[model samples]
Structures are given as C-alpha cells and as structure tokens.
Target: MPSENQGFSVWGFIKGFGKLLIGFLLLLQGIIGLVVMLLIVGVIVSVSDNLAGGKAARVDVPKGAALLLNPQGVLVEQAEEVDPFEKALEEAYGVDEPDQVEARDIIRAIRKAKTDERVAGLVLDLGGLYAPASSASKLHDIAAAIEDFKTSEKPVIAVGDYYSQEQYLIASRADEILMHGFGNVVLYGYGSYEAYIKSLLEKLKVTSHIFRVGTFKSAVEPFMRDDMSPEAKEANLAYLSVLWREYAASVEKARALPQGSVQRYADEMPPLLEQANGDFAKLAQRYGLVDDLKSRPQQLAYLKEKFGADKDGKSFKHVALSRYLKAVGEAEPDGEAPNIALVTAAGVIVDGEAPAGVAAGGDTIAKLLKKAHDDENVKAVVFRVDSPGGSAFASEIIRERLLELKEAGKPVVVSMGSLAASGGYWISSPADEIWAAPTTITGSIGIFGLLTTFENTAAEIGVYVDGVGTSRLSPLIATGVGPLPEVAAELIQQSVEEGYERFLRVVSEGRGLERDYIDSIGQGRVWIGETAQGLKLVDKLGDLDAAVAAAAERAGLEEYDVVEMVEKLTPFQRIFGGAAARAMKLAGLDFAEARAHQSALRKLFAQIKGEIELLDSFNDPSGLYARCLSCELR
Candidate 1:
C-alpha cells in the first residue's frame, strides 16, 4: 500500500511539470507571432510611405495644362518627416508635436506654377485642406502670384465644396471662383476667450499671487477675474479691426473689384440668398463671388474638352503641385546651396532639451541654432515659430542664439504660425523680418511667473511645515510654506519688473519702435497680424513664401533653394526607441498615462515624506503673460 501511494505522488508531480513546460512554450510562441505581425505591418507602412514619396518624382507638363494647387496641412517654414509612429503615438497621447509644411515650399510652388510655360492656368482646390496660419499668408501670397500670372493673360480658377471666411479670402484672388451646387460660404470672424480657475483654486485652498506688467496683458486675468477685462477687450478689438481691414483689402485687390465691393458682397449675401429662393450657389454667382456651380466630374470634363486629349486618351494635361514641384527640382546649380536650415520653435518655451510636442526647449533650440550657424552652406535660416510662450529665461536663450545667426551675416526671417504670442513674440522679435497672416495670433509682449502656497490646505489637514536656513528669509521661501516673505516678494517683483523692461528693449530694438511707444503698446498686449503691422511689430502681412523671398532678397540673391534642417536620429537611437515602445506596448502601458501616473506618484511620495518640492507645473501666468487657455485651433 505504501509503494502504490509513492508511485501515484511521483506521477502527479511529473504531470504537473510537463504541463508547465507546455504552457511556457505556448506563451513564447504567442509573443513571437505578435512580433512577426508587427514587423510585417511595419514593412507595409515603410513601403507605402516610399511609394508616396515617389509620387514626388518628375512628370512632364504638356502645354495648355492647368496647374492644380492643392495644399494640405499647416504651412510651416520647414517640412520634416520623423517616424510616423512617433507622430501617431504623440497625437494618441495628447502630446504636442511640431508638424508643419515650410512656408518657403508653398511659395516656391506658387512661383514655379506662375512661370511654368506648359501651365496655362491655376486651380485652387479647397477640399480637405486646412491652411495653417503661415499657410494662410502663403495663400494670399499665391493669390498675388496668380494675379501676376494674370498679367501675362493666363486664367486662375478656384473650386471648393464650401468656403469659410479664410478660404473665400484666398479664392477671391482667382479670376473665376467655382463652388459646388450645394456648398455654402460662411464668413465668421475671430475672438479670444479665457478660462476662469479662481473658484477651483479657492476650493483647493491654494493662494495664487498674480503680479503682471501690461494693462493689456490679460493672460493672468482668468485666474483673478471671471470675465475679460475691459483692457483686454479694448486691445483685442483694436487688433481685430486692423486685421479685418487688411483682409478685406487683400481680397479686393485679388478679385480686381472695387475697394468696398467685396465687403458689400459679403454683407449682402444673406439677403441675396433669400431673394434667390435660398439657393446658396445662385446667390454666390449673383454676388460675383463664384463664376459657376459644377460637380468635380463636370469640371474635369470641361477641362478635358478645352485642353484636348493625350496619346493615352486622358483628357487634358493635369499637373499636380507635388509632381510639378518635383520636376522643377528642389535644388539649383546657380542658386544658393540647397542646405537650408529649418529651426522650429513650436509649443511653449521650456528650459531643457526634449522631443517634439512639448514646448520648444531652450537647450534644444540653441544647440540646433548653433549647428546651423556653424554650417557653411546654410545661406539663410527660416525660424518657424508656433508657440504661446513660456519661461522668460528660456525665451531669452533662444533669442540670443538667433541674434548670433544675424551677427554671422545669415539672414533670419521668421515665419509665424498660429499663437505666436507673449514669449513666442519675444523670441521672434529679433528676426530680420517677420511674416504673419491676417489671422495669425501674435505679439503678446509680456512677462510673468507664479509662486503658489498651500498653507491653508496644510492647516486643514493638521499638517505643518517648518524649516531652518542660514538666512532669515530662506525658511519662509520656496513652495508649500506660508506666504512669501516681504523681502522675497519684493525681490521677485523687482525681477519680474526687470524682465518686463528687458522684453520691451528687445521689441524696441527688433521692431525699431521707440521706447515710449513700445511701452504703450508693449504691456503684454496680444495682436493679430494687421494690428501688429500697424503697430510696426511685424514687417509684412504675408506668409512663409514672403518671408523666404524677404530672406533671399536680404541676402541679395534673386533666387535660392530651400533646405530643411532636420535632426537625424542615430541608428542606436532608433533601435532603442523601437525597443522601448515595444516594451511599453507589451506591458500594456500607454506612455502618456504612464507619465501622468508617475508624476502623480512622485507628488504623493513627496507629500507623504513631508518634503517641500518646487514643482515645474504648467500654469497660466497671470497679468501680461496670460494666454488664452481655451483658444485652440479647430
């Protein structure tokens, strides 16, 4: 009986070990299968991108062909292609990444289209196209280019499913504007809205001391007040008015109409549509806003009939902008070296070097600028700035490096994208020339910093913080304690004041404005491009192409090739990044959530240990430096 029991136990143990080994093998096989699948998908994507890249290869343009100008995405001062997976992940996680098409590229295309002998006309297609602020300026500039083409007796046509105010403004420049039968044109203006956080802070028992310089600098008003300050309202109105006027004038010039006629037409649209039995297309034609109402197939057929058929029986010689640009080539033998350096200062201004999406780090930008400056073939530099602004010291660091470029005799032109306000404007102030669209948000000349205390929260929780230091004011200083000492407060206030003055000095020098005038307009005031133009803050109301033209002109070159500066990640960097991403995915960790969780964990740990920490949290600095928290691009 004992021998039989021992045998049963040994068999049971053997069975258990065998099952464990089989389970382990299955798990390994599953992991290998997943990895192989990912590799296959990666290969497919790579091949697809390669094919898309090949679409830029040269194509012949037959005579009498109409150039199709389809611009998709934001117009940047430079175009860069990092790993698309990185870009996709960043978007998925709600992190900010700088992705834009260079303004110079847009302008170059327009110029080429205008001069191409085989191109008989131009087509402005507004389908699935979102013009970035810089692109808006480029569109206007391209409209002007089309007008220049018209001088040679060529025609320009614009077609769209619907026309927003911005699209209408650009299409107005076409010799003939065409709309879909069911399309609508809505002319809505711009507005700035602030977010109020006073009540939330109050509930949390956190006291915020807001000290700011500019009366028009309402960036900090949301925390202190519930609504827009009278000063902010007045400043925004002034700026918007100037911008609207400029927009109206540009549209008029492009359409070859009377000065006030476009405005009159736009204003009379609602009543005219009512009179036309509510047919939007009919009203558009009646007001001379559109020349015809047609479908895409019909438009294509009409072009085919007009231009004749090719040997392959394809009607008309249609040259896409991408293909046309490729044929023209991005380089020139006699033109300046195709070594164009594109430096992007996008997002908020931060202290250290980091990857795309977050604010432009001072260290990252400075290093890039230094590298570009050192490159002998980089004849000109295009500083593509799209930021709301951040740390005063960081902005200064970037601005200083830009100054170094100017000192080195390289022409620096700024291509302002959406929300180039406050610290954004500060860094851009040093550019040799600034280009902005009528709708571009820019020029917030202001300075601010925050110091928050949770004394009330600590008291409520029956937790007290005590400190001892060498200096009398040291113990009372830092975060999480009682109110700042009077001396320390005075010191910070003075520092802020000094920063404001320095900001004014930079603006005065950059814009060539007087100190008094800058002070009057400078108090952290945000302005649209038109008001900025009137205030002499921006050099021109134009886009990236204009900036590049200005830069080339400044360099005394009639034409130059544009080269985009991109940081090339090493092989090891790419390998490590892929490995890390795969590991995260395997662990079911969403990187963004992981980061937030880690931050919260650190904060909780610090609290539990009764430690005073200087947290570099994202905050809307009040007063002159306060930005529109809810004002994001649609």
Candidate 2:
C-alpha cells in the first residue's frame, strides 16, 4: 500500500531495531553472568579466609560467668539439609532461622560447664524452646544432664515469659523458676489424632486400594475409614497413657510436688485461672510451679546481682551455650584411641541415597556402616535410630548391612530415640544390644501396601482408557488411568502378607524367641520403652550415652573415643564448610528465630503443604511400606 521509498525506510528501521535489541540482550546476559561470578568468588574468598584461620576469632568465657542455656528450636537427633550457598546468603542477610537443635550439643554444653571453674551458675532462657510430642526421650536426656550439672552445687535458674509443656519439663529441673506477670504454663497430655479422608476421596471420585497385615496397623486407616478404628484407639491409648504418666511423674518429682500434682494443675486449669482472676503468673505462684514473677528488667537485675554484670552493664556476664562450646571445642580422640562409631539413622527410611537430616536412605546408612566396618580404629558401632519407619524394601537393605557388620565381628548397638517403630525396629533387631529411653516409642511391627487411582475422575471427564495385553497383569500398566485389575490387587495383598510374616521371622531369629510369640506382640502395637523392655522387645532402658557405654563395654575397650560418623559432603559443599545444616545453630550461629512467632495462617498453609509433600514422597519400588503413621503423638 505504500510507496517504494516508504517501504525501504520501514525495512531499515526494523533491521536497526533488531540489531539494538540483540546488543541489549547480550549486555544484560553478561551483567548477570558477572554478578553470579562475583557471588561465587565472594563465597570462595570467605571460605578461604576461614580455612586460613582468619575467621578463627577466639570466644572468651569470663571468669565467674553464668552458662546461658538458651536453646531456640525443636530438639532433634538430626536436622534437615540446606544448600550451602543459600545458607551463607541467608546468614549474611541475617534471616537464617535454624529449625532444629541437636540434643547432644545441649547435653555436651551442660556437662562441660559442670566442671568448668570459670562458669559460676546455669541460666535457662527457654522462652523460644519448643518440643514436639515425639521428643519425650530427648527431653528426659537433657533433663538428666541438667540434674548431673546441679551436682556441682551451682545454682540453676530458669527464666521465661511462659513455658510450654516440654519447656516446663526442663525448667522444672531449675533450682528457681522465674516467669513474667502475664505468662501461663499450658500442659495438654499426649494424644494420638489423625485426619481420616476416605469420604473426601470418594467424593473426588478417587479410590485407595489398601492391603495391610496387623489389625492395629492404622497407617492406611485414613484411606479406608472415616474415623480411627477401635483397635487403633486401644493400642494408641496403651502407649499414650504411659508417656503422659512418665511426664507428670518426672515433673512432680523435680518440682517436689505431690505424685498427682502436675495432673491436677493441668485438669483444674480453668478453675485455677478463675481463682486468680485469669492472671496465669499468679496462679503458677499459688501452685508453687514457679518461684517468682519478674518483669524483663527485674529479671535482668536479679541475674546481674547474682552473677556480676558484664562490662556493658546491660546484662549479666554470661557465656551463651553456643559461644562456650566454641571456646572449649568438641572432644577429639587423643592418639590411637579406639573409636566408637556413632551413626544416626534418623527421619523416614527411603530407598536410595539421601542427604543427612532428610530421610534415612537405606544405601546412605549402609555406606556409613561399611565405613565403620572397614575402619580398624573403630571397635564398635552405636546405631541411633529415631524414625517412624517408611519402606519395607529399604528397611531390609539397612538390616542386611547391620548383619554384615556383625559378621565382621564388629559389635553393633542400637539406641532408640523418641521414635523407632515398624521399619525402625526392623533394622535395630539385628543389633547385639538394643537400648531405649524410658519414654522412647518403639515396636510397631506392621506391613502395608497402598495404591491410589483416579479412573473414576478421569471417566467423569469423558476420558476412557481401554487397552489389550498379552498377560493378565498387562492392565496394571494403565493403573491410574483405568480401574486396577483384580489379579493385581490380589497379588499386592499377598505380597503384604509375606512381608509381615518375614518381619515376625526376623524378630524371632534376632531376639531368640519363637515366631508365634513375636507375632503376638507384633500386631502393629506401639509400646513405650519401659513396657517394651518388660515385653523383651528392648534389652534395657537408657539414653544415648548409656548405649554408647554399653557398646564400649561390649567391644572390650576400657578407654575409647566416641566419634559421630557423618556423610562426607561434596566438593562444593565442603568449600563452603557445608555448615548449611540445621545443626549450624549448635555448631556456631549465635542467632535464633522461633516458629511460635509465625502467623497462624502461614503455619496452616505450611502444614497443608507438608502433608501433601509427605503423601507424594512414597517412593518404595514395591509400593510396600512398613511405616507407623499412628506412632505420631500430639
């Protein structure tokens, strides 16, 4: 439509613009690359500085200073993994919130402070501490350490705005308990609760095919029923009641109250609050739960007067738990001492390799055991299990490795943490000795297989799957798109039954008991350590330290060094010190952010996301699980 000159001008402008756009894009890409390279170089320089001892700033512990035990996260055996670069960047931005603290670090700091002449007293600042229902064993272990610390006769004071049930357990060990004027000590005894979603799934036109052995195996109940089965309730209550009694009894003993005083306080909280005009701090004082009520400034003054003020004069002269650990350093083996390899098998068991603090990968754990077996200095191994179990196939992989260690004449001892049920018990059964804390939840021997399909939902959308196969199992290929074949379901159920029988046999052979006797107690029934010991499911009731000692004794080592074996990081991770782990908080970070301060809506969304992710993480090759969903306590 235009003239020849107009067309030529238009073509020239288009060519010029294209060339400019290309140049702009290339410049932008180069800038981005340069920025990335700069970040990497900065990280390298930081790491190099640290390696060359430039970052080795000494932590000084003042004479006559108090040891500040201010743990600021959920206590765990192992923490979740994180990316090293992201971790360092988060640290730089000062937004890193370590979600977990190791029980060993807390115990180590307390034991070290007990004999350190420079430390004058112990101060508990546990306002940010949270303990989940499963941390009963860990809590007791820490409480034991606190008790041992008091033998030095140094005054131990607990200061907090309020105390949670688990927080109160640790605080109860303090010689004097201090609270804010508006604070409350809320305690709800342990209970097991789960969301059953069968009706919801039916409404969504989805089917959940579940095959399980063990009448009490409620792991698949959420898919099969709208509510908990009566058998599950009976079994759960059996263990729940024992854990609650232990909690109350320990608190009562520590606080010097009557045997049932803790229970009475919790049950009568409403009336007690009414009597004190809803002032919880006053109610706590009346019940003798807390010794004094002090505002923040007043609490600071008390500590300063007792321990002597710091140079800044704003607080007492005290060494924080983390700083003091850095000052003293972790214990290292003195020349050629026999090593007791301590390996932690924590989190749900999955099949292949997984990083530490994630799932306990069968292959990953096997590698650690093999490493221990190959080490001439390592005389024995203590396998610490803290899991609710996961895949049956993965569990077998781990159990076989433990057997290999034993065959090599290396004694293997198992120390159960808060949880070691189902698949957890499967691997631990092969140990020379199994030790569990009095409150450790163990023994939910069960097997189950689950398959979910959405054929009905697909058909509702006018999508149909029709296929022909050469064999009866051919239709199984279209499982999620079409209805499952009857033959396939029957075969899966048979496999589950076989897995259960194998579980009973393994326990019988390992424990030297009859298979029938093991079956009687292996009906997916969960048990606390004290009860498990009585049933001969556990050899003794003890914590990790005791288990380590037992391992040492079994290995005939009069003097040995305890070495916690961990997976080696990759080159990139090692360059950044891989201090990216949740354990970094205990390792050296001096900052904390508590999850209790998160918005309720954010927490709800996070919980929902976690639930969806967990369901999606079922990666067993055979679709067979030896997990214990009912073992979780609330």
Candidate 3:
C-alpha cells in the first residue's frame, strides 16, 4: 500500500529472515546427524571390544567333564538367525542375544554327548530356566537322551535355588535334584485365560458384530459378552483337566512321587508352610518334591567331587550345551545326500509377504514350499507349523500348495509345534501325515468374522450419516457407520458357516475322518496332542525329527540329508529394515504387546488395533477368518 520504496524494504527484510531461519535449521540437522553418527560409532566400538575379548578368551571343556545344561530361558523351536552386523548392533544394546537355547541344538548336543566318553555325566545348573508346557513337551527328546546317557552309568545331577513347573519337569528326570536352602518346587498348574471387553465397548458406544459357526467358538465371546460363556468355560476346563492330569502323571512317573503330591502341595501350601515353620525348602524335601536341600557352595563342592574342577577351583570344567554343539559338528550326510526339505511355517498366517519374526504370509510360505517341490534334490518335505492360526484364505493358500506337492509325488508331512490350531491346523490338514508333540495345541477348526461399527459413538456426538448407496453391501463396515444392516451381517455369517463346512470337508478328506466326527471335534475347541491322536486329528505323537523320518519313510529313502528351507534376506535389507523397526519400538509403536494397565476403553482400543492390523494381512475381501483368538498360551 505504501510505495516502491516500502515494498523493497519489506522484501529485503523477509529475504534476510528466511536466510537466517534456513541457516539455523541446517545447523540443527548437522548436530542431529553428528549425534546419530557418534552413537553408531560408539555402539560399533563397544561391540567390537566385547567380541574381541570374548574371542580372545578361552572357554575349554576338559575331557570327562559334565556338560553344564544351564539354559537361561525358555527353549524356542528355533533360535533367531540375525545378520552379523545386526547381531552386533543388537548385542551392543544387550537385546535378544543368546539368552535362550534352541530345542534342536539341545537335543543334538545331548545325543552327541551321550556317546562321547569324555562326557562323564551332566550337571543341570537350571539357573531359573523357565520352559513352557509345549516347549517342555518338545524337550522330551532331551529327557530321552538323558535316559540313554544313564545307560553309560553317567548320572544327571540337577542343582537349583528354585524350580518352576517346567523346570521341575526336567529336574524330576535328573538322577538327583538338589535344591538350595531357601528354594522350593513351585508347581503352578496350567490354565487358559483371556480378557473380555463387552462392557467397555458398550460404555464407548461401539458395537461388535461377531459371526462365528462353532457353538464353542469363544473367540468372539470376549467382544460380544461381559464374561467367558458357559460353553467356553466347560471346554476350557475339559482341556485344562487333561493337560493338568498329563502333567501330574508325567511328573509322578518321573519322580515316583505319590499321586497328586504336586497338587496337594499346591492346594495346601499356606498350611504346609506353617507346618514346616515357614521353611519352604525343608517342606518341599519332606514332601518328596525334591531329593535333597543344599546351598550353592555345597552343591558346587559335590559337583567338583563328581566332576573335576578347573585350576581356579571355583568354576567346574564343563561343556555348555550350546558350545558343545559347535564342538561336535553337524552330522555329515554320507555320499550323495538325498534332500529332505524342512520348511518352517511359524507365526500367524497372513496373505502376502511378511518378515521373519512370527508373521507368516501365505504367499511367502507357499513360495517356499513350491521351491522345495520343484527342487530335484528335495525328495521329501516336512512342513513345521508353530502358529495359533490367522486368515482362513491364507490357510487355504498354504494348504493348496501342500496339495500341489502331493500331486507332484513329493511327500509332505506336518510337524506341529507348541501351537497349530485353527488356521494352523487348516494348513496341516492337507499334509500326508501330521506329527505333534505330546502337549501341542491343535484342532480349533472354526471360522469367525468380526466387524466393528461406530454408529452409536458418532450419534453420541451429534454425528449422523445420510448417504445413498447403489447396493446394500456397498458401504459394508464403513468407518463412521457400523453394525452393518441385518442382511449384511447374515451374508457374513453365511460365509463363515461355509468356511467351517469347508474346513470339515478338508479334514474329512485329508485325515480320512468322517465329516460329522470332524465337526464334533471342531467347534473351536482346542485339544492337547494326545487327545488329538485319540480324535485322529494327528497321526503320531512325536517331534520334528519324527516327522522328517516319516517323510523319509514315505519317500522310501534310507539315507537323506535334512535341508532347512529358510527365507534369505540380504544384509543391507536386514540392517535398514531392522533399524527402522528398532526406531519404531523406540518411538513407542510396539503393536504386539498391548499395555494392559491402561484405561478399560484404551485397552479395548489397543486390542481392536491389533485385530485390525491382523485383518490388514488377510487376503479374503469378505474377512472370513480361521483365527484362534483365544489360543495364545504363555
């Protein structure tokens, strides 16, 4: 408004300020970059130093030394395989670096150590190893290996401050279990529990339209009702009873304790503690739960007398199970190794491609199977399943590939892990034969459709929807509107019913079981592997090695090398993707672990977020899911 002079002055001021702001921003970015680079460099140097020292130090196990089986944590089916650089980075941060042992390596080492005459006996410094029920079932092989070791007149001695239920299971198999002065065998029985949130949804004015075919399908009950339905409770009790009974029986058989000794100890703990004058360790020994009570020094002295100690007189000369695996290299296949492909199908079954840690996309797993089928060297395939289940369409995709392998004369066998229920079982149904561990969870052959609506919530804030659609189902599950029209809900229910029927048919055809019988067993009811055998859902009760042997037998091969089929990722891809993932975690974006202590509505929303993300991976446009929502057991 002023004049040419005023205009020039204003323009010069704006240009100068803009330049100054840009310079400040550039300086800030440079500082941030320098900080980040320094952090990376520091991490690298720290990791290199630790690794150098470790490599320089010698950890030698002398001959005739008892291998120390001091597992730090639970045994997973497989140990994580990280890229070298990423491993260094994670180790530098002290995150997820060799904290747990693999079941396969444990079994391998025990077997190789059984015959190694230098191995005098085994020392179990359990060190608070917490194995899950399913993991304990998988470690039956380790127990068997120990039994074989006993034939060599070598005792398996266990010494620990305390023993968890699973730890006691392993310790009970030991020739002698030595408990610390203050330690006791705390045996907590097994039970499945899940959170429900119907009241929260009601309070938030959100509605959940759950369509499921199984009468026992309690997966959606948590959303539709305020508490676990009577049917689900009954079903849960039945399975929990079986599992508990099995556990009690096994422990009793191993330790020769009286029937219900563990149960009695658990039930009468308070009074029993009073009876023992509050000495739990003495009570445990008096009750025959432990063989003896000794302090760490006393136990160490005993082990030193049994198995010679090192020159320092403190640490026993022992071979760690993990280190012993490297000592005795993998058994080499003789002559031309006939290939027996071991393809791992671990994690939730999504639709498309997914990464390594517990997200198995259907297309990705199918590709792995197809590759194994097409490979001339692969004479047999063992499909190892460790998922609780996910999308029905994805399960069908994986099952179809197994059928293709069958058509191509490639023997396909399924080896079930801790969990192989619902979608997990769907994929396993098409296998030539199914092998499951004793405590493997399987057979929840049901389908559910979950659709959330926010109609009431919107109306609570004076929001309304008045839109025209060409078709009735056109706006199905729209964001603002929810509780789809009755007709739409019926359509989704019909689809789920059809999927259930399809599941029954698949099991009927594959397992040679009758449809009615399969339906009787389906109904979203989980069963232990032994009950599954009774129901013909599983062929033999065993582990992965047994399944591979079955595959080899089916293929008529006496000598074959077990070839693991794993997805390969380049170092650059792994490093960048992992760094991004770590950044997301650091940014408080962890999706799997929903913060439970939040407000009820917040917790419900977090759960809903997880379900929505799961749905995003599903291939089915109609959202026909075979997920066992209540099947996760820690």
Candidate 4:
C-alpha cells in the first residue's frame, strides 16, 4: 500500500513516459507516410509535365524580320524543367536562384532570326539586364550574327530606357537606336569600389592579421587599412586604363563613330536635352542617337503595321528565344573534320573540381585545356573568359597550360566577357590576342588575403587559451586565435612583394610593356574594357565573334566549325552524380524534418551544425586566394 502523494508521483511519471513513446511512434509513422506521398506526387508531376502537350510548342519567324530579347542574368548551362517540389521548397526557403539563359539557346535564336524570311528587322530590348561579362560576350557574338542578318538588307533596332556605358556599347552596333521620351543616358565611366573592413573591425574591437604575397595583392588591404594601398592603386590604374581603351575602341568600331565622337556625344547630352525643351526623345533624334521616339504601344502598333498583324492583333509573328532555338537545329560537331574549340572560363576561381553554379576549378580547367591541346582536330582555341579573378596559383596553372596550347600551334585567342580582371586578365595575357567589349569590366591587377583574430572576443567572454609550441609563429598561424607574430608579418609582406614583382613581370612579358612601365600601373586597380585598351593590356577591342574571327585568321582557316568544349558526363556520372545531388536536397529536407521531429533543443543543435558546415565549406581551399566575399548574385 503506497501513500497518496507517492501514488500520484508514480502515476504522473508513467503517464508522461507513455505519452512520449506514443508520440514518437506516431511521428515516425507520419514521416513515413509523408515521404511516400511526396515521392508519388513528384513522380506523377514529373511524368505529367514531361508529357504535357506531347512536346514543346514551336514558333515560326518570318524572313527579314527578327525579334531580339536580351535575356540576361545568370547563364544556365542547361535549362531543365523545374520540379514542383523544388519550386515549393525554394519559395518556402525564400531562395530565389537566378533564372538561367543558356548561351547555345541565344545563339540558336540569332541563327534562326538571321535565316527567317519573315524577320525583316530586329529589335534589341536592353533594359534591366545585368549579365556577367561571359554572358555579355556571348550576347555580343549573337549581336554580330544579327549584323550578318543586316548584311541581307534587314535592319536591327535597339531600344533602351536608360543606358549604362556598357549597354550603349552593345546597342552601338544596332542599325537604329531607340531611346525613351524621358530617358537620360549617363556615361559616368568605371572605377573599382573595394570594401574596407579594417575600420569596421576596429569599431567592433576585432583585429585581423593579414598574410599574402603579391605586390599588387590588395585583397587583404580591407582588413588592414582604411583605403587602397599605394601598390594596389598603381596596378589598378594601369589595368583600368587598358580596359577603358579596349571598351572605347570596340564601341567606336561597332557604332562607326569617329575617334572621340562617343565622348563628344556623351558630353553634349545635357545641353542637347536642354535644347530639345527637356524632351529626351526629341533630343536623341537631334543627336542621331535614335531614329524614332515612341511609346511601347506605339512601337508595337508600328511593328504590326509594318510586318502585318496575327489573328490576335499582335504585331508580327514574335517568337520566344526558347521556341526559336528549338526550331533551329542544334550545332553538332563535324566528326570528319577539324573543329575550333570554344572554351569558356566563367565564374569564381576555386581549387579542385567545381560544383554546379560556381566558377570552374583549376584542375577541371587544366584538364580541359590539356584535352583540347591533345586533340589534333582542334585547330584553334578561343578562351572565353568572364571572371573577377581567384587563386594566384590556379591562375598561373591555367596561364601556363594556355601557353602550352599556343606553343603546340593552336591559335589561342581570348574573348573577354563581362568581367576579365586580375587572375582573369592573367590567364588572358598569354593569349595571342584579347578581345573585349567597351563596357566589359576587366583588369583588376591585385591580390590580397585576410586572417581574423578572436583573442579579444574570447577574453571578453571569460575564456582563456593555453598552448605550448616549439616556434613563436605556431600559435599565431591558426585563424581566429591571436595576432600574428612580427616575424610572420614581415615574411608575409616580403612574399607579397615578390608576388607583385612576378605579376608585373608576367604582364610586361605578355603585353610587351617594359617592367618599369608596367610597374607604373601595376598596383591593384580595376577598369572597364575601354580604359584597358588605352594601357595596351588588350590587343583588340571586339566581342567573342571577333575573337573567333581573329583565331580563324591566325589558324589560317577560311571555314571552321565552332565547337564548345563542354565535358560530357558519363552514364555512371549521370546516375551517381544526380543521385548525389538528390541526396543533398534530401539532406536539406532532413534538416527540416529534424526540426519538426523534436523540440527547440534539437533545432538549436541542427542550426549550429548548419552554420559550421557553411563556414567549413568557405574555408575549404588550397593555396592563396582573393575572392569577393559578398558578391554571390548568381
């Protein structure tokens, strides 16, 4: 016989234990059911979507009139149909991945537009489009193809509300440029804006110990100084100058404007607009910047009247890029003949193999270069580079391999994309020639590294560290531990100086500039293509098509097939790699599951783990590297 209080306690414990067990079992069953339902739904949705309407809709374009839409953002290598579940997950997570427009798709659209008998004219809508340089390079190629259409006596119309200097450069090649009735054009030019973190950290009572080698290595300056270093400033100016020259020249040739006229037109705009009574459209017409000033509806009406209306009253037979591409056959490699390899070096520079949606890995690119070099049928190589630079060693490895390709008798031409700066420029330096767009961001000849210390933070938190080491630099060598020793700092500075010297040497040798002359502009600097040409960093001011033409001329080929150097995944890779990707997505799902399964205790632990994983991934690199930490637009 138990007392009443003891009986009550025993009963409560039993009830609570039973409730937890039952809840656990119910939760497990619910998860199982949910997973099965999700799988079934996913399979059904995938099948239905694939089978809907039998196949993709196709559209036909008329000859001599082409519809051009500058679909710019992130470039997707392949555009796969979106899964409903993935879309839902993305929406729930507030993750808006950039929509991808494939290069091949754009090329196909241009080819179709050029051949279509109904397409008597083309319209380029250049508004709200900010693409990577590599993407712009491809766009420029497509524009050139459109120019070929113009040779057939068809006109290309370019329309923009407000034009950045680069946008104007692209539009300059159009047969007619159209500006809005109230739009303003501002060509303020280009400059580098690096974030300085030293002062920011100082305010937080945090210190950073920087270690790097490269005279132009300004990457670490943000951590140590409030402004750009002297070495960085010098290198940046020369590189930017070279970029600007390239840009201006490209625009000049494309627009058929005389020397200094582009600048003159830009400078005269304020007064020109004022003279037109503030009517931008009238002003543009007066300056020959535009042929017509019309509203969207008016333009559409004009187009309809010119090309005839569809049954729905829509002007002309306008085809979307995807449909047009489907109508035009994909470019296939000619197995019996030699091919010109177009290798794209886009995205961030990282060590090892790159995952999807990031810049390629050095090892991966090296392998591709080696393969292209080995292929005797690959008569010429066009390196399409659109990058902001990355690891110093990786850049050198790529540059060295490219030099080897050139040595092997392959005419290697570099086509600068939206960005070709720092390491990007380094790799391009060894090319036989470099082609850049007027607005292309190029030539950031700088380097940097950062190591943050948490000694003060630990002390403030009442934490202390005790360690024994054989060398004075041992403890300081680790990150977030303490300040670097003086000896270590000196060694790092010397290493940076040596790297800067080597950087200048490479540029000097490659660009035909003397060491002293190169050094004069060798500090870490940034430039647009127009500025770079003035400094002679770029050999030619043109787009990717121009680069291909140059390569063909160098290779002495009157007709050569353009073949992209893309790695074809093996069947095993398709199965295992896809499964791996699926697993990752599932892991993310599992994280959500764990949160839902347990109480706040489990959620906190999971979140901490996730943060650690992210940090670990960021720190997983080999050798010295300089990367823009905040720029992850794609």
Residue 99 lDDT (model 2): 67
Q: Residue-wise lDDT of candidate 4 within 1-634, one digit each (tens)?
A: 4698899999999999999999999978866766676566656655654665324455555443456556655454333333445555556555544466665566566666666676666667767455442344454555567667677666677777766665665677787776767775555444556768777887776877666544565656767888877766665565454444555666667766678755666668777668889876676566655667767776667666655665576555455455566566566756876778988777666666664345656777888888899998899999988766677777787888898998899989999876777777888888888898775667656555555677777677776666777887776655465655677777666665676677778888888889888766545556557667887888878876789999999999987888887665432333334443444555575456534435557557666865574344343243345443212212
Task: Tell me how many clashing residue pairs each candidate has.
Answer: 11, 0, 1, 59
In candidate 2, what are the lDDT values of residues 236-308, reduced to their tens digit?
Answer: 9999898899999999999999889888888999998899998988999999899999998989999999999
Best by lDDT: 2
Where model 2 places Cα greater than 4 Å from the true spot, the runs are: 1-56, 81-84, 88-98, 574-600
Candidate 1: 10-residue stretch with minimal lDDT: 611-620
TM-score of 1: 0.73
Q: List the candidates ranked by TM-score, beginning with the highest.
A: 2, 3, 1, 4
TM-score of 4: 0.73
TM-score of each: 0.73, 0.91, 0.84, 0.73
Deviation (Å) of 614 in candidate 1: 20
lDDT string for model 3 (559-625, tens) is: 8899888786543344454565555444446533334324457657756976787667566655888
Ranking by lDDT: 2, 3, 1, 4
For all candidates in order, the CA lDDT equals 0.69, 0.87, 0.79, 0.66
What value of lDDT does candidate 2 attain over all alpha carbons?
0.87
